[model samples]
Target: MGKPTGFIEYDRIPSPVRDPLTRTRDWNEYSLPMPVVDLQIQAARCMDCGVPFCHTGEEIKNGVSGCPLHNLIPEWNDAVYRGEWREALDLLLKTNNFPEFTGRVCPAPCEGSCTVAISEPAVGIKSIEKAIIDRGFEEGWIQAQAPQKRTGKRIAIIGSGPAGLACADQLNKAAHNVTVFEKSDRIGGLLMYGIPTMKLEKDSINRRVNLMAEEGVEFVTNIEAGKDIPMAQLKAEYDSVVLATGAGNARDVKLPGRDAKGIHFAVDYLTQSIKDNLDNGGVQTLSAEGKNVIVIGGGDTGADCVATALRQGAKSIYQFGLRDKLPDLRAIQNPWPQYPKVFQMDYAHSEAEAVYGADPRQYLVNSTEFIKNEKGELTGLRTIDVDHVDAERNLVEVPNSEKIWDAEIVLIAIGFAGATPSIFKDFKVAKTNRHTIEAAKGFYRTDVEGIFACGDARYGQSLVVTAINEGREAAREVDFYLMGETFLP
Candidate 1:
């Protein structure tokens, strides 16, 4: 242990963020770097408990309990606390293929399960993880090391998101000829488009992609599977095929005037906004400027829309959620080692509040209809307050709670349904009731031999860390299938 009593001596301090008011003007990252000494102190605060549930990576009650990647938390905390920067990086890379991505975007269930958090605040695990990887890059400790030999077995990955990238990296390291095909013009599917720039910078993704290219992972962009190349052709050409295509079928709000001119899916809006920022000269195809925006559904995506609309100079913003606000502390049913159900404002919510003088979220509200003008342009929405009236948590509208909200533009930010079915029509993979590929949990194989599935396509929408884990384990299974035995870990 770094320090037996360090957890008692030091209280948890979160990583500092940029001022909400000031950061709203630009499209830069919200996080600022912590001094090395401060980071070491934070690292020393790790409890290093005997069980260390922080890295257990268990699923409890439909939610993940710990780091899905099973990161070496205690070991790396000790290395960082001792000022062994290179050793910390090595320990971190042993399990995670892309710490840089997960460190920034993951919700950090590890902190929720931290032993220190049972009573006090948890250690800044996510911040420290980001620092370790960032420092590795700055100190020139990270470099490409291509495999020494090739097995001459060809493999094709159908997506270039986290899962596809992780699977490609692992398979390449195992001396297999791996190729990742992306439908988009650039790599990093959700990372490139679904996320806003303030949360995760595009350069960080590009840097990792470049490193992977140097390490002999071939990335093919602007080429979609089952479109440009037939799935049958791909199956015949490659020795193995792994489907990592993400869940693109977004869940939508099917209310009145759903096809109104200004109504759009949250992912479509975010994708266009990001593409304009990157490809065009910041000329938004779907600008929210000077319009009253209403975001239906509350989650990370909805918060991102609020922040994006703020930056784009929206007149007013509001986010509607079907559930009530979370409690200040964990509820009675929520125990330790399970993800805490508590209230905390994310970065976007804080920024919106700073600009609008109040929290932009309205809890326990549901949109009943979308009001539109004669030209078929959205003008407003009809909503009603709802409540969980039974043990099943079914939403029931409150009496006399009908209201009208002014909104020139509306974005549906509900979660995804599953993978787009049309893309896999040629492959003919069976699907589960959840609309995801029919792969038994843990065994990524489809019914068809030599074909497999993983990540969001297999498990439905989940965390980036979980996608990476799926990719790693899928690679292990594929290696075993090909070589009769395997050594991947």
Candidate 2:
């Protein structure tokens, strides 16, 4: 450890956010870089726990903790504390293929399992990671290095999302020719579209894509695998095929008046916004300007919808959550070393508070009906408070609690239920109960030989880091299947 007692001396600090009044006018990232010295101080707080559970992502008794990527947290923290920026970057890149993306958006389960967090606040691990990668980029440390030899094996990776990109990166390093196919206009699937610009700038995604291209990975955009290019053609053209297409189909709310004109899916609204931003310099589809917007669901996607609506000059915004309000502090049930479900405002919530003079969140509420105007356009919604019981574990509306609220535009941001079933059926791949690709335990393979799946398509979730892990693991399986042995670590 570079600083033995640094954890006792320093307090946790995070990066600063842009002022709400000024930042809401543009579609750019709202986070400001913390000073390098301050970042180093934060890195020094990683304690010398005998068993650093932060990197051991195993589910102990069905409750998983720490990073899924098993990042070398304490090692890199020591490197940063010793002012070894390049060493820290080297250590970071060993496991994580895209630290910049994870550092920006990951929920930081590593911090939740931090030994020091049992008493004091956890070390600013995410911030330290961001600083390390940004410093690497600025110092010309990150560059393209193509393999010297070619194995003459070709791999066709379907979908250019995080999982596909990670697989391509690894297979390319093994001297195989790799080409990534994307259905959208851009290479990054969700990162380039689904996420709001205020959280993750498109330029950051572009930088990595460009580097991957330079490293002998071919990117083909605007190519839908099933429709434009048949599955038979891909199998014949390439020796191996990897399905990394994400779980993009959104879960919908089927209440009355669901087909109203102003109602939209979260992914549709977000994807259109990103396309419009890239094409015409601003959002065009589903404008919220001067309209009362009600966003249903209380996850990161919903928060992003709130931020995007605010940027679109919405008249008033309201976010509804089906779950009960969470306590501000950790509860007895959620003890230390577990990822506590406590209340903490995210970036979008903070911005909404500044503009609307109040938090937009309304908990323990569910919409029963969507009110419509004379023209059949959505006008408002009827909502009610609900109670939860273990025996009768369904949302029961409160007595006389129904009320109508203005809602010109409604965005459903409920989470995804599972992966798209069409692609799996087209390829004759099996699925588990969750509708994700059915892979044997610890081995990511499909029913058919020479075909495999991973990432959101396989596990149905996780962080960017977990997606990368799945991709790396699947690539190793493919390698072993091809050559009868693999040296991938």
Q: What's the CA error at residue 325 for candidate 1, in Å?
A: 0.3
**Across residues 277-354, which tens digit of lDDT does each residue of candidate 1 receive?**
898877877989999999988888999899899989999999999988999999989999899989989898899889
lDDT of 2 at 186: 94
- Write candidate 2's Cα lDDT for 1-489 as tens digits: 878888999999867778987899998888888898988888888886879978987665455578888899999999999899999999999998899888888888888899999898899888888889999999999999999999899998998888899888898888889999999899887888888778888899999999999999999999988668888888899998999988876789999999888999887888888888888778467799999999999888899999999999999999999998789877887776777678989888989999999999999898999989778999999999988866556777789998899999999998887788787767778878888888874678888778889888888855677788888888888878877888776
Candidate 1's C-alpha runs over 4 A off are none
Q: How well does model 1 score by local distance difference test?
A: 0.91
For each candidate in the order shown, give its overall lDDT on alpha carbons. Answer: 0.91, 0.87
Model 2, position 30: C-alpha lDDT score: 89
Q: In lDDT terms, how accurate is model 2?
A: 0.87
Q: Against the hidden reference, what TM-scores do the models get?
A: 0.99, 0.97
Q: Which of the numbered candidates is closest to the native, going by highest TM-score?
A: 1
Compute the lDDT of residue 468 as modeled in candidate 2: 84
Name the 10 consecutive residues with the lowest summed lDDT in model 1: 421-430
